[model samples]
Target: MAQQRDPRGSRALKELGDRGLYWFDNTLARGAAALVGWLALLCLAVVVPVSTVLVWTDPAVPASAPARLAAVWRLTGETLRLGGKTGPPLRMTMSVLLALVALLYVSLLVGLITTAITDRLTELRRGRSTVLERGHVVVLGWSEQIHTVVAELVAANADRRAVVVVLADRDKTAMEEALATRVGPLGRTRLICRSGPTTDPALLSLTNPATAGAVLVLPHDEPGADAEVVRTLLALRTLLAHREGGREARPCVVAAIRDDRFRLAATLAAGPDGVVLESDTVSARMVVQAAGRPGLSHVHRELLDFAGDEFHVVAEPALAGRTFGEVLLAYATSSVVGLVRGGTPLLAPPPDTAVRADDRILVISRDDDAVRLEDCADAVEVAAMAAGRVVPERAERVLMLGWNRRAPLMIGHLRRSTLPGSAVDVVAAGAVGIDRSDLADGPRSGLLVTVHEGDATRPEALHRLDVGSYDSVIVLGRDPAPGDPAGEPDNDTLVTLLLLRQWEESAGRALPVVAELADDRNRVLAPTGPHADVIAHGKTIGLIMTQICRNRHLTPVFDELLRADGNAVRLRPAADYVRLDQETSFATVVAAARRRGQCAIGYRDHAAVHRGLGHGLRVNPPKTERRTWSALDEVVVIGA
Candidate 1:
């Protein structure tokens, strides 16, 4: 304060310093060449003076200023690698010129080498390099389903070495990390990720789709995902056509579209041989099916996933003339469900149907390696076989909580599957864009639908609806908003499940609940009783896609299995197939089911459920294995 020295002067100096810094930064930003030139000049200015002082300070140095200056030049030249030779002016000039020329050549070579290395590294980091593989699986696009698809592929290939190449419009490292977290160990499968737009044919070629055995076009979980899937399929088709060069054979393409409107477009783009699945329709069908049967979702999950017994088509030339009923008990470890004849799958064919030499028997077994034929017909107990017949279908009431895009389809399927007297009470917070006129005039007229505006997650709303009065409950999750995070849709479903569980606990009776979740991980968080079923829409679609990729013929099989009118999987009373409280081998159960025109694959034991033994379910058990049949036990069978 005492020195109130020129405040304006200080401000001017500060501004001048800032301008100098700005100039220096701008100069350096010009180019690498300019930066190097400045670096060289600055280095020379400091090195020369330091070298001169050292030379003059040395006790043995020449006293003349000219000699000292020459010594300094020699020292500076050597330090800067510009020729340190001390000689006559002409010789010094030649040495410096040669040194400069040599420096220039070395700098140019080093720059070329460095630039080449950098470019190659950048290409690698950017995931632009092409994958060189044969018979590998090429996956186009990325979504939540990618994890399930890749994991199933890995498990399906655990017996042999295989490769799975993924090309998506995402960072390679990020994709790798996400997959690593979702899909644990990859086993014998090798995964390669490339980053680029899947709609670009040039980028699609990075995965070598032509050489791939199968290509999966995954649709993202967002608006217009079906459109994007259609585009990717078109690009892939173009790439494959270019690579085929007039060849008729093409790689198997499996794709899915969320909306039915784009299903035809995706199918056309995928070619006649390709498979296009309507994911929304399938999900809706599964939810309705699960609502009718509590443990049906688990059975479907077991059949779709690769961890347990799955469908396998094997040739049994030795038993070509054998009847379908005899073939049912042919394999002690495998359960024969149907056969593939003339490139078509016939599930639960007539018992009298003869197995042709060209036909492949479709059986559910732990693995293809376990589909060995053994005589188990002798294990059957004729006395334990039930003489019961199929019962008549009855109408029931179903309660639907929450709503989404799949609700209308679910209602449609429900209406078709249920009898005319069946009623469905749909309780949602709002109408959710439903057209009331369409439901009353169309095929949906068979089933009476009542809309109630109430939040299903609230306990008061559920209590008011007389939650325990309904025969079955279907929990449909709401769709996410425009900028919602992944799995956020499942929150409402989980809360409703908890409330339902609380109601069950207070009432001292288990409620039959089937929930549709957006994320598979959220399934674990759901509070479920033995009768509750949680179906993850993404997992179901992913499993179906991977199944088609493994064997394209199974598309029809899945289509029929998910349909209510077709030979669908059902959980019937064990007493329907076997005598209650009687000890009999599973082969006896299988034989009894065969007589009833059904295929018994497994059984759910109510006693085992109380004991927590594999949730009281066993699929593809040995035919020779015997167990006591209780009325509480239900037989898992595929029937019409």
Candidate 2:
């Protein structure tokens, strides 16, 4: 039961509460009372001594003063009756009281001032304190992509101080709040946010581009990100070129390339090491490559992502002044993946080659490249080269069986590999638009873009292109409209391949049929067997997205990976099978590619028992390379 309270106590509490005093609550009231008492005492220290001095010093300090003094003396005498003090304690007592008041006043003043100064100073320190270190990476721009970029930078900079400074025109506080809410928390990395235009160098200075280890100029949200990256690069270049602003000498700069033409421009402006990420071009290439080589996108992902091991530009002192193939064997135990010698990449050299000084030796290894190599079994690569069969280069007429979304990209990649004046006939069922206005138009001239209208799936229409005249036919997936819920581009490609197989059979020889399959389930429809290569679009998209999530920095890695030449990724026939050794080292393959100016990071062997498992192939081999390899090994290398 609730007890009745006392009225006097409730009234006292109400009075205290009305004055913002809650003495009814014991702990709170004690604290408040103590504060007020101290303040009142401090006031007394000022007021009492000054009042006494005014009375004591005045000439007219008067008869009233004498009367007040007499009254005090009378009171003192009454106290003397109670034995308080002798002779009214006049001279000694007054002197002690005045001295005590002065001491108390000085003490209170000093304490209050010290507390105020210290509190303010500490607040200032806590508010604006942050540190950015050397070799730290900076990302400029905010998108759904920035989240992926941030997570990757944290992993990459794990061994060191990996700072990812974000500079966007958005609210700095909001960005930081969003990051904290999304990623939960990150370590080592200090996420600094700066507000301003990304194209502005002064805002970029917050990233300390000059002192920064590297800068990644991300594409903005608008269609103009490519242009912004270019402009940002120009700003970065201006920063790098200038001697002012303590810009830390401009570490390395990387950017995303939206257009092919701009990629070249960015490369020139940013410097030799600068990387240009061509998003759409690469995404399109992955789809095309996956169309031809199933699960290759996964191989690209593991190599490019920061979570796993990959290629790096390491210095090969022994390879300096040595032949390319000779250098490969010299470091046989260690793979001399490629030569970044004087910025001239002589990757995967042929046997009996030479290496020079000032070459940044590009090699592939497991982990983030912290491992040290004592020796490389590169010498055996030359001997193996002597035994392995050379991939015969055949010059033949190639006809395009069908054309669709990846048609232009296939034509572009083909331009790099195709002979001068090679005929390419586009067999499309609908009106094949070959306008120069489209961004898909190939930069090279003289490549024919003839569009023949007919049902490509029908055997008669397939014959119209004279499929036998061409040695290779690449069938592209059709474009699907947004409203069409049941469109099947890969199904159409498979049908075209089915029709083309008849022509090849009629000619009494097998022509390479490279077709794009949107669904991996339709992969088995190609009757040309191994003679025809099927590319799956879904797998490539998944791998690209997965790899980006793993390490968004890999955009450049894929960019270089899809390029036809100049330090690019390539698939080559392996020297030997893996039947003899259960332990096949990546260094053995790396050793092989080095001999041929190639970087062998991974492989795909048809003879492997579990060939289709884990995206077919992802080989990050053991550190040592003493084991023998079997004939089933397929060497995967990268280099010009």
Candidate 3:
């Protein structure tokens, strides 16, 4: 060099510069913060040094070093539009260049800040923020059942302010829009949607499960839904364990599993206080029950749905020590259907059985608050007991249309409900075959199931079956289309129903037809038929899941009711409980049913059944209400 340079000083400076560059690169690679920070640093470093140099070299500049420094600061502020006046105005060429440099720096700063803000907003919309709520209902996962569950919850909490927070792997805006389209007005209930995978512990915590009132885990509509449900339950458990209050603070968790084999594992995963429902078995049992007894699905819909009368467990001390039959008349507005003692529901218990002080009466009413016991002894008019006759079970011919995975289970149920020599003919478009070995037990139980290959939707195929020849015809919902699984199979079901109705009209006879539907909305869309009973599968399961989430104890009660064995809800002949063609009070009807070891909850008028008027199926009628019964009217009862 010109003058011997200090090699050590030069090397030291080089090392320092290398370290600084390394740090800057690492920081820049970190994320949005680093990018913004680096941009800010570069702007300051360039603008300050350049402004100082310009101030010192400019023709209209201060002479003193202190004045020059002050002028540089002023110039920097003015360039950044931060406010300040520097020396005299520069020449035209210099002013233009300075203004362009200032504009460049300002644009860079504005762009960085805007980008940071936009990114933050996007993250928020992605539902990464934690929820700060207590006593809210947390729904984990998204599916068709969500709409029904949310609507039911909204309806249940109509009189009170409630919050339902939805956590699922979906766009927050998309979920909100879908719900808005499907669920209409929510009344006083506030619905909050969050976007994230429900199985993530971090996301689960965002739902505030530890402080939630209840948690409903809906299985996604995909393969291995039960596996996902189990995983979600595990995540919830982990979140609950880490909560500040510990296990005691955990909310009630309820989930629906599709496979019965996985039910035990899911139940254990849900803890002692949780509930896991086997949805497939429940739906299969429902199909069988509905096929055996027309209008039974409607009865279940009423009891399970929040829009109508539902089951409530209320402790009525006023009825303590009184016989169940006597207590039945104690509620003018509510109907006492069962007794729960020691956490066991005794539906249709003995008439003379005493109601203990601690017994909780299972009452059916429009709402829990509406369930009231009054002194209605004078209001109840007990009619004179008339001759009652039990309808004997007989072998009958049944027709089944379409097929799905539920067919085998439904056939087993049919065998249990029907008599020996009962025949069931299954007709479908495809040549789907059922293993005789799988249905061997059905024939031994007196029900024979045969599968026929034919398109049931076609008139020729339906005509060949002689629809009027069967006692009851079941049109099971077909497998969903590959392209559109959410689409309802009701089109085929509706066509089959119309054909059956036409056949009945031509033959001058009515055939009881129980049609399985994929969507509840389709029930209204399909033409109403006198003999048709539509069972909306998704809606039914959703209703059951919602009911269990509200009260877990009902799980066992519903299980016992839907099982093939033990006592079940049946629509027996009205003559079996009371004399037909004679005006009788429901009080006498209740007593008559009790005499026959059954409980009469309601009755379906024959006219209603023949005309497909569901309103005629009255449940929990007033004890004082009197009506003349027809021979064809069926008494809705809980019996073995």
Candidate 4:
């Protein structure tokens, strides 16, 4: 008996193991094959014109010429003729042959160009994609935020080659225009763009997530940004649930969902690997902190931006068995403020904490600090030198000029800080849907949660909110209710900002203002005078999303940065450190930061500030300008 052979079992079992990878391999192979085949075909076609000219122009033997002519005679070389005399048969034949050859050549040229452009156009029409490469980040969205995220990623990845890919609904040209205008000036960064809404199932495949190290999903302008995030979560889950074998899916996906409700939904839909960034929550928190502390935003700028103490997880192998406090006192030239075990991070936990082998140390210093730790120091002395070890004496009264769902969260965080004992008010036309009862008690045993209802766009209404009473005013643009028209919230936010500036002008006072803006286009209208701060909320969210997607473990690092007392975002004058006498080097910037007892990371050139582009400030200029940083320029940081 011929032992019956089982058929169709090999591929079936293999397919069950890793269907996506198999498909990805096949697709790539097929595309490569098709591309090569097309090139070969085009190369072959080139011979047609050359052969035609040779057969007609070269007086080959009469017999050979006629034979070749006969072979090519099937098609007539004719078109709408201009008034002219017809040449002799041989001359006419040669003319016709030349015309046919020229037409073929032209058609080939157009076809090649048209196809290349059309292929790009097709990708641009859809908005999400993943680069199939390790240690490379996949940013899924298109907007002004892309500029900042790309710039920072370039700086963070300066030590290592990094690739940042963008996926958005805009055409390739649109994405290219955004990159050129907003992010191209940043350091050496490789960018790839694809088209497709990140929420779509079919479109997501274009990102090639299986091999990506991280993925960043941006906050959308739609009222339902959260809902869309949920959809994206579902899509990601579907892709992940197929149970692919062999290759572990390590790509970390971080998406920004503006609403708390949607953020919860996204977590449920996606897993721990899927991070949902609540923009309102973070913005409000940052604004509140900055309001309480004059330069805290500057500190945050350094932490989050590539220009300063960017947060990173450094392995403290020597201190792995030691307590966090002991490590903090003994470790190198950075601060060990927090820990992340199995991807969950504790921001600024107690110092006398045990360190585990798997824990990722959250440190704040220059980029190199993450790569190496030099020594340990006294916790108290370190505290006085760094920041936040002691609370400040100043009491800040913060006024929120605009309202969004995140207002309450921001206010709550402010109360937790030194600002809780004082007044905190939220002024807005629409109702902020949040339960005030959930907030913590204050020095008076009850936190101050004041709501001043008014039209922020009206100068008089804005004046009524008493912007001058507070040290800083956080202006949050209204969020679109799920499914509202696009750009409406941005327009409203812009109008409200204009009204506030008008009030400031009328009153002749400039109070500190940290505003959450919906559109990057309105940056030109942004107030840049002292105490005026405009934040592209979406762009900020996008940068954070891009980073967490790039390095999932860094979330804890950012959490610590935003949590610390001396925590402030800063952009130091670029010229302070880099000496023109020194040879070109970004390391010089780092050295100067160390001297100032601060961390120098990256630089923001003059162009960004020229037009009040705000968040458009590109960090990490290429090594070309590494030799020296100018005073007109600034390095971002988070310190006193």
What TM-score goes with each of the models? Answer: 0.92, 0.55, 0.82, 0.60
Those runs of model 1 whose alpha carbons end farther than 4 Å from true positions after fitting are 1-38, 49-65, 87-101, 387-392, 441-445
Q: Show model 3 residue runs off by greater than 4 Å.
A: 1-105, 244-249, 375-384, 442-444, 481-485, 606-614
lDDT of 3 by residue, 1-640 (tens): 4789899999999999999999878887899888867776888799999998899789888688878887887778776654555545554346556766787798899999999999999988887777788899999998768999999999989899999999999999899999999999999999988889988898778888888989999988777789999999988888888885465457778898887778888887788899888777788788777774777887888788888888899987877899987877777777777899999999888788999999999888887788877745565334555566555768988888988767777787878777788888888777466565666753258777777899888899986777767888888767665445564566788888778777877887767778887778787766545556788777888898888888888988888888776778888888676667888688777777777767677888868755755547898887778898887788887768
Query: Clashes in model 3: which pairs?
Result: none
Cα error, candidate 4, residue 335 (Å): 3.2
Highest lDDT, which number? 1
**Lowest summed lDDT over 10 consecutive residues: which window, candidate 3?**
84-93
**Clash count of each predicted structure:** 0, 40, 0, 40
> lDDT for every model?
0.89, 0.58, 0.80, 0.61
1-640 in candidate 1: lDDT tens per residue? 5767898999999999999999999999999888988998999999988998899898888899888888999899999998988778898889989999999999899999999999999888878999999999998888878999999999999989999999999899999999999999999999999999999999888898888999999998678899999999989888888888855367899998988899889989999999999988999989988895788888998999999999999998999998999999999999999999999999999899999999999999988889898988899989889888577888979999998888888888877888888899989987665667645635445688888889998889988988888889999999877667879999999999999999888999989999999899998899988789899999999999999999999999999999966799888999888888878899999999998888999998878876866467788899999899888899999887
Residue-level lDDT of model 4, residues 29-125, one tens digit each, is 7766767666646754764565566657746435574566643432223211211124456766666567657766987999999999988766445
Model 2: which ten-residue window has the lowest total lDDT? 77-86
Q: After superposition, how far is residue 60 of candidate 3 from its true place, in Å?
A: 26
List ranges where model 4 is wrong by over 4 Å: 1-135, 185-188, 243-250, 319-326, 329-332, 339-360, 369-397, 411-426, 429-445, 448-453, 456-468, 480-512, 520-525, 528-533, 560-640
Alpha carbon lDDT at 569, candidate 4: 44
The lDDT, on a scale of 0 to 1, for candidate 2 is 0.58
